[model samples]
Target: MTLASQHPMTMFGPDFPFAYDDWLSHPAGLGRLPEHRLGTPVAVVGGGVSGLVAAYELMRLGLRPVLYEAGELGGRMRSIAFADHPDSLAELGAMRFPPSASTLFHYIGLLGLATRPFPNPLSACTPSTVLDLGGVVHRVRTADELPTDYQAVADAWDKALQDRAELSSMEDAIRRRDVPAIKSIWNRLVTEMDDQSFYGFLAASSAFESFRTREIFGQVGFGTGGWDTDFPNSILEILRVIYTHADDDQVSIVGGARQVPAGLWTRTPGRLAHWPAGTSLSSLNSGRPRPSVTRLSRTGEAITVEDSSGARQDFAAAVFTPHVWTLLGRIDCAPELLSVPQWTAVERTHYMNSSKLFVLTDRPFWRDTDPRTGRDVMGMTLTDRSPRGVYLFDDGPDRPGVMCLSYSWNDDSSKMLTLDDGQRLAVVLRQLKAIYPDVDIASHVIGDPITVTWEREPHFMGAFRASLPGHYRYQRRLFTQFMQRGEPDARRGFFLCGDDVSWTAGFAEGAVTTALNAVWGVLDHLGGATAPENPGPGDRFDELAPVDLPF
Candidate 1:
């Protein structure tokens, strides 16, 4: 995969495009530390993918990573199995991943995990998609089967991206690993449209001038489902995903997304710097991580962490990976731990709200054919009603199935935030009944329903980061904070890593890549250095760092 030819575009860059995938695959390994620092301990302040990756790699680099968690081990990759049927489960947080997330896939491959195509609307894996808008139900095998209104919206969106957002040039640059071109085009957009919202950008597009078109585009959105809830987000946030192909051809892990972090926790690395062959993060922490982190502060040249068990430990360096807002609420963070601008970035971080309702079915009833209409009883669905987007999962004819009854975001999720498990299930069933009146959905349900409003989860204050307009500078500050140079002495050893600390906030790749960034940061802070043959993200920081816009 040379830079000369156009390869499939992964999440390399429209922002910081360092080759984390390459660095991870190198035989020389990530870095080396002084003999005295070989077994030095580093505080990993969260158990999410970001923290897990950070700890896993730190261990491989000959450092001990002490893991701490405030809640579940996997965090947003929350998976719960229905009793006796481990295969039948609900993915309450992240369910699908795009191949463009090369860094994340790298870890998945290392863990020897299998993945299958996810059933997105009108995708090859989806048998059918039913769109219900304004009480009218339209079923389609492909987007072409829908009425002209849908086609018009699709065309308008393409036109809007090309004309208003420079979609083609940016995408071409990314596919070619053209960092200069990527930064050139993206930096101009950041400076020019830092204050623009997704809705505002669409409204300004000549193709999306009609109020009706915008409504339809939002309702019958491409890929997963409607994105009306994302209208208030910064346009740059949307463009970065689009430009990186983060929304295309997504797949779900075989068992569950939880396996990613879970694997990291237990699996021993093939190439470790100091630890023995059987050593793993699980073994390092005695098969379980430390309790919830209650406070974080600077203790004279070291980072001090206090856990729920009333244990306080100071580490030479630390990686912070929880939700950025947690620094303000759940964790008592010292004010001196971050610079003023960095604190402002953390303070202004905007996290999107998301809710999911899932149910285990006696069988894959959604695939059953209707006697009269000859159509499947129900298919993957998209509706403007309360249920919003519904996805069907089938194992085998003999095996039971799972269905994500409703996956809603932002304001839609807000309404269900107050609903209990049963209430949430009832709300989805009510709207689903309106669409499939002839089918008795309740009868097919097997076990208890699984529900979650991420915003309501105490540990995770919100689902994931989605920047608001005028937040470009703030986001840039957070993304680049890992470099840690020129920072006040008090904040030097504390590294920030997670999806929110990345250019593309919601993707797990962000968590993994940023974790790698923190790994490089910690390595350097503790007198370690990457092999000259395989430079890490930090090594390429000056050349490929994200475009920083003036405040």
Candidate 2:
């Protein structure tokens, strides 16, 4: 029987009908605060997607949320525009967004932004894909065109998922939003696989017994490219990515991915509580957000926050969305702000280093077809060479195009950190020329290359979190921070929300999900209520929650 026939309800994987947009648009709309609590001020740190989403939702709920940021508002959703070609953009951080990111799509639809299928390695948009490993180049028009050995690797991955993880049944429950069913399946898996590394899982699988097959799988992954670095990570983390289909059917915003949060910053709500109908997040902050938060401490029932400029204010509650290292090292946070275990969780959190280098081309030269072969001269490329992944962007035949020469992670990224922009561009161009000997990549370059090493950036210590094997207990403590307000001597007024604090880390949806959780937590702290008919996640958290790993 087909996989779908076995689990008919498994349509969209873990992306269920959470209806976050509907909850925000309900008649009561996240419920309202008491008359006296209206306009109660709340502090929001960081100006990234999470903090911006939290501030936006809180404002709609009759709360005055003061936002503080150390850098530009979009955070990792940064897009750099070419000097000569303003329409051409180079995404330094998040580029492709999966269709499974429902909460993010809600805002994308609301903002009236356009998106097109991203040119991932083997996607339809990618006219051709060249996979070069061990100096052997294999060109394919579709995934099926790949060599027979690659097919075996793909089949092995499928069999492993089904045999070890009960992939079909778990996915069926997740897609249907069957809370109890999901808990039952996920809880057992958490207990079974929590201690295993992704590499370990693969090694134990009978299908991947051949070391050569395993090596090929690591270098050239299924949807994207390369899983070598991820092999050391928790197997549970890999399962989450696969089960959610977070790596498939991805698209990028037409202008830039950063436009999502930037749009939210200026978007005016249809129905608001304390503010006027036209009041936007920008207007609420008097056209500029407060300075970055440098210190935080709890005094009585209120929390006091100090900014980089030494300005201070007290609020009943605060939300922190920056990398945990920022709180531990850059800011002077009081010990009482977090419990000992929570602090340990923060300290143990692992963030991956990422780097990208981009150049504006005079035209989409890669689209040109070679007469002899009848194939595009250049296409999306994955190589064992220094430049791991090469992506081409075409605005129009007449307009300038952008090319991401190199997008590397971890060690690949760190090696280039010491090189200046010019040096990095030279290295990338050399690598590209070596891969495509006939394509004159350097001559098409029309502007200076732009590069970003996320680790070297002081404001953002790293790109995103990647959980190590056996780190589930630490992650559980961090993910459950929103539920600790009621505990005695707990970090009552302070809440944490970010991709790092989510079960599925390193995705925009995770950031948005955790942000909404903090919003609900703040609502509860303010004595507000969620509508009974449309209960928020927090209202049913116990029933829908994932299993917590026992220490």
Pick by lDDT: which candidate is best?
Answer: 1
Q: Per-residue lDDT tens digits of candidate 2, residues 499-530?
A: 89987788888888889889988888888888
- Model 2 clash pairs? none
Q: Give the number of the best model, judged by TM-score.
A: 1
Which stretches of model 1 miss by more than 4 angstroms?
A: 1-6
> TM-scores of all models?
0.98, 0.96
Q: What are the per-residue Cα lDDT tens digits for candidate 1 across 1-551?
A: 45533587889877777878889888888989999999999999889999999999999999999999877789899999987788787999889999989989999998999999999999989999999999999989888897899999999999999998899888888888887888899888988888999999999999998999999999987877787999999998999889888999999999999999999999988788889999999999998999998999988999999999999999999999988898897899998888889999999999999899998888998888999989998999999987789999998777788999999888888889888989998888888888999999999898789888888888878899999999988888898888887778898999999998998888999999999999999998988898899998888898887776654
lDDT of each: 0.90, 0.85
Model 2 CA lDDT for position 41: 90
